[model samples]
Target: MAPDWPAALRVYLGVIAVGNLVWEAAHLPLYTLWNTGTAQEKLFAIVHCTGGDVLIALTCLALALITVGHRDWPLRAFRAVAAVTVVLGVGYTIFSEWLNIVVRQSWAYSELMPVVPIIDTGVTPLLQWLVVPLVALWLARRTVQRNLVVTASMNR
Candidate 1:
């Protein structure tokens, strides 16, 4: 049977939203927007960060789904989510930090932000990708699995 694309998309969006919020909250101290900026500017910053985070999360999800080899639902979910956490965490961290901070000067890290020893990237952004995705995926997986179990029980 074909997968329900709409339902899957809703799940993905839900996960991304929650993950972005968590990341923002956690890293706010490390990455502050300009305090003197107008409300519109601050809003733009918030939107930009949220949008970028959603894109990265979606990319990770796509890569995970494509790479997951298992036919079994639970195993496939576990593997896919784990893959997403690692791949997106490391890959996006390096790429984005370099592009935004080193190359483009899009955003500057606060003095409070700790730099990773070797990579020279802020620790918060790296942890954001790692922690938020894992938490979001785990929550989504549990919710889906629980619904599936209930549906199966009802059908039986």
Candidate 2:
């Protein structure tokens, strides 16, 4: 049997929240470690880490919570949340890369070479964009299926 669209959407939204929270939580240690390092370490860290990815991940979680609901509210809210997450994620990712480049230019590297920033800024937003539509479609399909089952049952 096909999955219900509303059900799928709920699951997907839950995923966005859980995934972002998990990713951010996982990075706390790394951020802490980086902060403890010297100034030289800081410069290197900024260049190497995609700080924007962290922000994007956080935004995803916030949007996910805002979008969750049992009825029409969830669907309506999904559109707004999805749009915000995509826009912010893209903007933040770009800003992160730009910051790394500027930091590298202004600061001098010690024994460690300046590393490239991780360009995974697009990952979270892209996944979110795909997820919303997929869930919507799944919900639609499920609704149709349920209607057909009900109709057949009534006829019999």
Candidate 3:
């Protein structure tokens, strides 16, 4: 039987939120704001960035679902969905870093931040997209499958 996609989605989103929150905090020292900003500002930066990360993750997954997913996603079309979602996320991160760093000057990275060539995007944010969502999807699927099995056993 197929695992419940809705339950999997909820688990996926929850993991995304937690993962992004941790990633944002861990990478704070890579940004200029970490040293230049006050304590409150640093906290705000972490929260704000984490919030944005969550939104991006949600949007990317939703788009992937619309484009490549079906009712049995993460089961039938797992690879297609995961690939599309990660690519969308990574593509958006690249564009956003370029925009914010070059055009808007909304933020700047510290010397500690290692940037990708040509793109000039920080590796941490890029890695965040690659690591967080992938882990989230994996955990979400495993968790849902376990729950479904337990429920089935209980009913038997």
Candidate 4:
């Protein structure tokens, strides 16, 4: 069985939406406040990072719905979006990891910054992007398999 592009896209979007919800819900308290020193820094981090994630979640949801509804369009749009996300995710992940390594290596010479670069921060959320296409393909295949099984059973 082959994967279905539309269904998978929807699932990917759903996953992203849920993930963003979690992120926003968890960080909102920290972001919405004004504080000094480390508290202020964390507040800023929550605002910048979680705000961007909310936008991504919205975009994914809308785009998924649009792609699913447009039955006549080619798959190129979905593929392009997925590929771009992958590239961005991979690039960010590598750059973040590299920065961490550099910081750690020069720890003695450099001033200790309150903020540290987390490798996974840049790498992990891309899972939803990657899953979109893969899951879409899987869904398509499953649908096909189910149809085949049902058809076979009917004949029997």
Best by TM-score: 3
User: Which regions of candidate 2 deviate over 4 angstroms?
Assistant: 1-55, 61-73, 105-156
- Writing each residue's lDDT as its tens digit, candidate 2 over 1-156 gives 332445544554455455544443433333433446676665545444324344444465356545542234333444555455565555564565356435544222232323334742334334433553344334544554666578779989
Candidate 1, clashing residue pairs?
none
Instruction: Please give, for residues 1-156, the per-residue lDDT of candidate 1 as tens digits.
Output: 322333544665687787787667556657545544566876677677888788778777767766773344333566665675568657877888889888998777778889997888888778777777776666656666666667779988
Q: What are the runs in model 1 whose C-alpha is more than 4 Å off?
A: 1-9, 69-77
Evaluated at residue 30, the lDDT of candidate 2 is 36
Clashes of 3: 0
Question: Which regions of candidate 4 fall more than 4 Å away from where they truly are?
Answer: 29-87, 90-114, 117-156
Which structure is stronger by TM-score: 2 or 4?
4
By summed lDDT, the worst window of 10 consecutive residues in model 4 runs over 106-115
* RMSD each, Å: 2.9, 9.8, 1.1, 9.4
lDDT of 3 by residue, 22-139 (tens): 9999999999998899999989988898889889998999999899888877676788888998999999999999999999999999999999988899999999999999999898
> Measured by C-alpha RMSD in angstroms, how accurate is candidate 1?
2.9
Query: Which is superior by TM-score, 2 or 3?
Result: 3
Candidate 4 colliding pairs: 2-140, 2-141, 3-137, 3-140, 4-140, 8-136
For residue 20, model 2's alpha carbon misses the true position, in angstroms, by: 10
Task: Give one digit per residue, the lDDT tens place, for model 4 in 1-156.
Answer: 333445545555555555555553453343223223366665565566555654554454455445453342223344554444455544553554356435553111112212235542322334433553345434443554555567779989
Clashes of each: 0, 2, 0, 6
Candidate 4 lDDT at 16 equals 52
Evaluate model 3: give its lDDT.
0.90
